[model samples]
Target: MPMKLYGVSDGPPTLGVRMTLKALNIPYEYVNVNFNKGEHLTEAYAKLNPQREIPVLDDNGFYLQESNAIIQYLCDKYAPNSSLYPNDATARAIVNQRLFFNMGFYYSSIGAYALAPIFFDYQRTPMGLKKVENALKVFQIYLERLNSKYAAGDKLTVADFVLITSTMCLEAIGLDISGYPLVLEWYEMFKKEQPELWEIAKAGMIELAEYNKNPPDLSEMNHPFHPTRSVK
Candidate 1:
């Protein structure tokens, strides 16, 4: 049986997984879990991921949650020798560091500062925006320090797949990416080099931006990420 990916097309994390899958030329069945339609909230979906997150990968009987974990597993299991994930300990460590940055800082900053206000119907505080700005500044420094074309290093790894989507989210949400010249250059080059994945990134970015333009009545729905609805 082919692997199954459960996610929506317009999610940043989901797009990252999709990019990784395509880059590795791995064939899998996409099982859309449209959160907007409350599909992900169903008990059936919960069986696959108790966290109720998208981008769950089901490879035969084994199920994996978290986009980064899924992508790494794909590369490791399907294409162990692929440079996109590297076999070298030091090189792979760098990629792992970048991926951690994305999960713990980069994407989290935007999710808190930008997406939170839009999704939860709250005003974005200056402090929140400052956190996001700091993340971008650090990202720029990483590029300049490493002097590499990609996030982790010179090679395009799983880190790039994850970072690029978050970067595009920053751009789509009207964040000024112009200040980070290196990030802008790298982002453009990544898109140019992988046009197919770029389409998915572009679509997800546009979808996010457009949805936030006139946010729907989320009051009727309870999201796990919502401040009041969050699980303790």
Candidate 2:
């Protein structure tokens, strides 16, 4: 059986993994979960991932959760020699740092500030918005320090895929990312170089924006969007 990727198409984490799979030319069956319909909360899905998150990778019955780990596993197993994830320890560490930053700081802020209100009807607060801006500023700092075309370094890596998706979602939600020149430059470069994958991400962003316009009814939702801690 081919590798199975479980997640929605436009989701940032799922999209990041999809972009990695495409870049490595790995063939996988995409199993899209309809969270709005509560498919992800079912017992069947729980067996695959107890946390009930999307973008779970099933490689021949070996299940893996978390997009960061999935992408790393793909590059390590399939494309060891590929610069998408270098074999050098120091270089790989830098990439790993960026991946963690994207997950913990960048994407988290965006979800709290913008996505929460849209998905779970959480009231947006001043601190939530500040977190988003601070996250962008920190990203800009990373871009400057790297002094390269990509987030990790001069070459594109798995980290770039993750960061790019977060950046796209950030921009999609009406944030003016133009203030960060380095970020804008890097994001524009992806549009120019990776048009197909860029469109894949853009389609998801468009869908998310539509949700913002017409908020969904989560009254009957079995598994609502509630993160561990409220944005502070």
Q: By TM-score, who's the top model here?
A: 2
Clashes of each: 0, 0
How well is each residue in 1-232 modelled by candidate 1, as lDDT tens digits? 8999998877778999999889888889999886665677778989999888787999997999999899889988999999999999999998999988999999999877766665565667898889888898999998999999888888889898888888887877788888889988999998899798888899888887876676644544566655422211
Candidate 1 clashing pairs, residues 3+ apart or interchain: none
lDDT of 2 by residue, 4-75 (tens): 999886689999999999999999998889866667788999999999888799999999999999999999
- Indicate the TM-score of model 2: 0.93
Error of 2 at 164 (Å): 1.0
Leading candidate by lDDT: 2
Residue 213 C-alpha lDDT in model 2: 71
Q: Between which residue pairs do clashes occur in model 2? A: none
Indicate the worst ten consecutive residues by lDDT in candidate 2.
223-232
Give per-model TM-scores.
0.92, 0.93
Give the whole-model CA lDDT for all candidates, comma-separated: 0.84, 0.85
